[model samples]
Target: MHLVDIHDEFTHFMANMTCLSVMSVRYSSRCILAKKLRDCDRYTNIINYFELMYCDLKVRNESKEIGVLCLFVLIYFLFFCVVFICINEYYLPALKIAAIRLKLNEYLAGVLLVGVANSTSDFMLNFSAVRSGSPTMNLAMSNALTSICVMGGTIYVIMPFKINSASVFRDFLFVIFLLQLIRFFIQTDSPTYWVKGLIILLIYPIYLAVNIIDFLLMRYNIRKLRREIEILRYKRSSPMLDKKLYDKVTTLKDLEVDDDFKILRMKTRYGIFRAGVFVTPKPLVEPRKVDVESNRVLFHNKNNPKNRFLFTEFIQDLNPIDPEHWMFSGKYGRAALICVSPAMFLLRLAIPMVNYEQIKHGWSKLLNCIQIITNPFLVAILLETAYFTTHNNSWLINIYFDKALWSLAVTVPLSLIVFVDTRTDIPPPYHKLFSIFTIVTVVTLIWICSWEMEVIISIIGSVFNQSSNYMTVTFNAFSNAVPDMIAYIQLSKNGYGKMAFGGIVGGIVFDITINLGAQFARSNSESRHLLGDFGETIYIFLLLTVFSTSWMCLVLDFNARRSGGIFLWCLYVMFFIYVTLIEANVIHDFTADTVIEVKD
Candidate 1:
């Protein structure tokens, strides 16, 4: 009994000592934390709290609202990401198909189609703004100028490519000249007559003519290159153009060269963070062969990232929108679709599906026969007692039936798109016409998605107490530019540098002339102005941005370089500073006419 009692007492003593040690360590840790907090200011305290989530800011739930911001940001990213996909995936594929089918130069097609499609959101936004009887078009004009500037700067900064296409600067020059032309029209106090707007709108045909001529010139060069390569092939007796031969043929080195003509071959230079933001030194792109005869790109491997944008890699993570995808996709694709199907159903309401080349759509006569009931879009737009009776035991068919007449209008033409598409089978030549509908539908989706995204962005900007003009210039412009920006950059990276440049500049031109013309043509009044005294400043900056880029390209002999990227970014910085000064009232150049400036 004595031995047991002695053991118990020793154990109790050890427990008490352990508890005292724990208390001492806790007290010292608290003291150290308190000292750190005392040494920090509010800004530092906030940083410390975020940097170390466990740290206290000496304030009560100051940034608890940050979660709200985060939620909104996540929502914004989702919508924004959708916009990105529509541009690159749906709209862009359509453009490519149209370009190839029409045999138009990629650069010209991008300038006309991608440019107009990309600017559709801004056009719609500004159109509605002006249609609302608001004569001020500061929001529209700011969006156009800021978008062009940011898009141009962002393209080169991300992926600089050689400006190889002939007369690429013509697009930029047209943009600048047309922009100034519109400025001259509304720069005065006279009512912006519909006649003047109509005149400005007439410039679009000339823009078309210039691009058509450029396309013809480029085609002549490409054809000449092909003929020369053919003649050289007869000498070399090479049946097909392989990688090494292509390098020689396109480059025209170590062989009889024609000094009169030149071909600017694509040279892809991957950025430091191009491969998943890691310093991976793996071969950036595999060598692929292009047959001038076939005009088809044959890849050495399936994983080649040639002609694909950076974000295209992440597309596999998203779900397919077609019902066939849900029915036929692998377990993973179906699972992804399942996760987003609810949102997709609503999103796909007015959006039509157009099948592309490799996956040409073929209407199964069986499916097309009963497509009235089988096709989701057709079923959505139509309903009958027979359908209810047939599917009554299986599922609720009424749930799929749409009562809206507009849905009928949308789905009627869309019903033809329900085709069984595969990679091996080729689609009909007539199917290329659907690219127009695809481009229009994708643009519509982008507009609706972006408009909602901007609503969320504007709310986010309001947290900083940002004014309407600031939101339009910074956030609204970004919303309009983002999908186009990423898409064009990806295209440029893929050696469509001239095409990308055309899309960027040509879109800006369309905005200034077509969109703005529509606004004034509708209102028949002077358009609303920019930030107090900042109207003329932004126009001047846009001109500078274009002029600077053009000068750099000409000086470099049309070689796209990192220095060009850096220079464009510097110009953007200067633009930002000037705009900020105006916003902050550091420089007030408001004249009598611009006093009643309209913010979005």
Candidate 2:
């Protein structure tokens, strides 16, 4: 009994010892795992601390980075200005020449080339934005609005003089009305989408007509007012009135009276006259009434026939002495005639007493010369010649005390020759080379400009409340519109009236539709779609801006004219003011908060 009990106790003790060893192993492993987890957590905290410090350093340096970026952008903008001015000076004439060579019809060419040329910078910017997969549709739309509202408004505020006529408001109002229609078209899926485009296309011409009519009316009113004022002034200054008044004063003095009575009479007369000195009656000029007989021109030589081919007659008909004819038409005509005149002179030289074989040889040389001279350099030379012929009649310099003028006279032409690649002696082959160089330089400038804009845009997006949607409304819109407005001024001055109108209204139309047309078409093809929250806001703001701008352009009779410029500008200012207030939470656009649910 003692031996069995001892064995049982030994077995129980062995089991207990094994259990203790297992528990110790488990405890040690658990402790090691816990220690590793604690170390991992510590490393994570250290990494987080470093990350925070890095972020703080970046925040501290952000102002400097922005400052540097702003400096670069400013330099780029200056370059952009330089390039734009050069393009304006050189590119326009070059383009006109190019168009002439292409044989584009005058009116069509004006509408397409002149109008489109002005907005090339904007087109390039938008093209780049699209290629980079940014929201270009919104960018383009915003740019248009900014141009119309902000730029238009600024011009008005700066110059708030009264307009003689208010016809421009008609076109402006029409555009605003059209914009509302466009908004509806954009928002709803109607069968009339294509119809809307057609309407937009047609509406621009009507807008142009309205502007032209208004301009003419303004000119008419100004002339009428001037004539009225002139008539009033003439009446006031007429010798007849002075003579009558002089007679009246003399008669009053000559009247018979005793000394005391005369004195009293003079005093009474003087009192009556004293009132006239302080407040005279307004001149009552008889209004010129129209008579049928008076209006008719009674020709002294109605049946006389004039010689058509006499040099004097031709000169008179051509109006060669007229400054306008000489400066514009004559200059262009002379340049064009140079090309033909050379060949004609060459032919005449050979034509006199020449054998057939010799004539053939002469003709071949003439053809070669013609080909050689038909280069862009020739155009440049022609321009220089025209400039010299008209402008050089009077010297820019004087012999005495005019060193600055002398230097200007000397250096300006030289600079033009070098920078513009204009030459009289440059040969045909070299002309082509110069043309290529010019073209390349222009393209390079444009490329650099676009790149700078993109970079600046990116910087702007990062630094401020850089939402693409809002930025489109503010900066992008303003930037794009500048080119169009500038182009309009240039083209209009050149008498390309249709072209100028097309560039502005056409740009707005194209930006609103075509830029996003592809996207919308594709999306609609796939399924029904709506813009996200940001896009919707942009569209709404755009609509509101257009409506306000249009309203500003309207007169009491709802006509458009330059007078609306001030009001248009005010609308733009109000828009920005409201936006600022809303942003600062002094106000809010509650529409932004409302969401409409659509059921599929």
Candidate 3:
């Protein structure tokens, strides 16, 4: 029975083994088939290698691009920051330092340094206008107005914040404010020359005195430091002199034995010491010699006798022959002129959205017949109506009438001359007369218009003790309207393409003037209420405006004729409006808060 059971177990084991082997073989075959299918359907090795290479290349390219872009951005940012810092801090401060060192008064230094810097912009604008054949009156008016706007606007914006007074009145009462007021009064016609001279001259002396005081203080501090050093030296002693006799004797020559020489020993309660005395040979000393002939002998190098003469000749040659060269070569003078003149031209040309390129294109051609007959006259009429409605003073009225007559006279002659000149290739004998008439007319018109605007605004403020916001808005609108009219006139006179840019200047002027004016007016009352605490926000804007205006003026003056009267008048109107807004706000605040209740 046991043999039968063992045989059955062995048979069962053999059967199970056979089944397992067959299953294993089938599984192996399926694995091989699957591998073959994958190989046939896709090029896995090639695809994987290509993908890896592509990824590597992509990463490399991406990193390089990013690095280059980052580097460029960093460089540009640093360049701009450096330029700004140098101009605002280093260059400006250096001038101030030089002025102080020279013992110039603060005002004089300011006039000489800052004024020249500032006026460069004006000069450039004026010069450009003259070059472009713009009427002198217009150029003058524009410069004056731009100056007033920059100064008054800056004060109006900054004073309120600094003083923490919401009232424009209190802000206006500051020293600068008072000075400006005084200046305004003094600017009247027929002012004594001595008064003007005194005012102008005193500025420099004040600047000089302050700087001198600073120099003295600095010198005192330096002397104090020297004294401290001397005191420190007195507290210490030299160790080299404290050595024993034996230690001090470095060589056998330092000691000598003579018949009377002796060694001595001494004993004390705390110590005993033995000493040897030695005398050395006499010290070697050189005899002093005085040469009487040395002083009389002119030491000249035989090989280089021509050196001195050559140097002298070089210096003489280098000396500037012309005064202009000397002035232009100076760092301050050149910097002031270069920086300021371009700035002024830029300022004049900068309207909102308008740049130098656009301005250049607009004024290239002279005004045409249609422009002369329609657009400018219409603009003049509208401007006059706006002025009359807001300000009704006799002086202003007369000025307005004068402006009208001048415009009409100038426009007609200019139109006729241009038409005749263009039609006939050669000017007639009376062309000179026509040209004179046109020039006179334009100049007179611009001057009258500017004077009228100023006088009218002043009269309105004086009588009403308020600014005409409505008129200010109208003036801004008119600025835009005039440009549109000019564009249309240009189209009529010289076709669309010729005067393509004529409209651009007007558009920019309108937007900037109106928006800026509105902002000033709105801020005037509020800013005054919070005086003596405003941050750099207001001043920064002022500075930017000044810079831009200066640049514009310079560029424009170089490129085109500009009407100073018109520019100045526009600026005057804006200033008047700003002042009024500030004053009114102050008055209102004062009256509203007449009584205050305190609670503990």
Maximum-TM-score candidate: 1
Candidate 2: residue 118 lDDT (0-100): 45
Local distance difference test, candidate 1: 0.53
> Tens digits of per-residue lDDT for model 1 on 403-444?
534555655555544333211122234544555655655665
The root-mean-square deviation over C-alpha atoms between each candidate and the true structure, in angstroms, is 19.5, 27.0, 38.6
Query: TM-score for each prediction?
Result: 0.62, 0.43, 0.20
* Model 2, runs deviating above 4 Å: 1-60, 94-111, 119-124, 127-137, 151-448, 488-502, 522-563, 590-592, 595-600
User: C-alpha displacement of 408 in model 2, angstroms?
Assistant: 38
Q: How accurate is candidate 3 locally (lDDT)?
A: 0.30
Pairs with backbone N, CA or C atoms under 3 Å apart (clashes), candidate 1:
136-528, 137-528
Expressed as tens digits, the lDDT of each residue in 79-102 for candidate 2 is 456455445433444444444444
Better of 1 and 3 by TM-score: 1
| Model 3 lDDT tens row, 125-159 | 22221112222222222322333343322222211
- By TM-score, how accurate is candidate 3? 0.20
**CA shift at 82, candidate 1, in angstroms?**
1.6
Provide the overall lDDT of each model, using Cα atoms, as 2-decimal numbers: 0.53, 0.40, 0.30
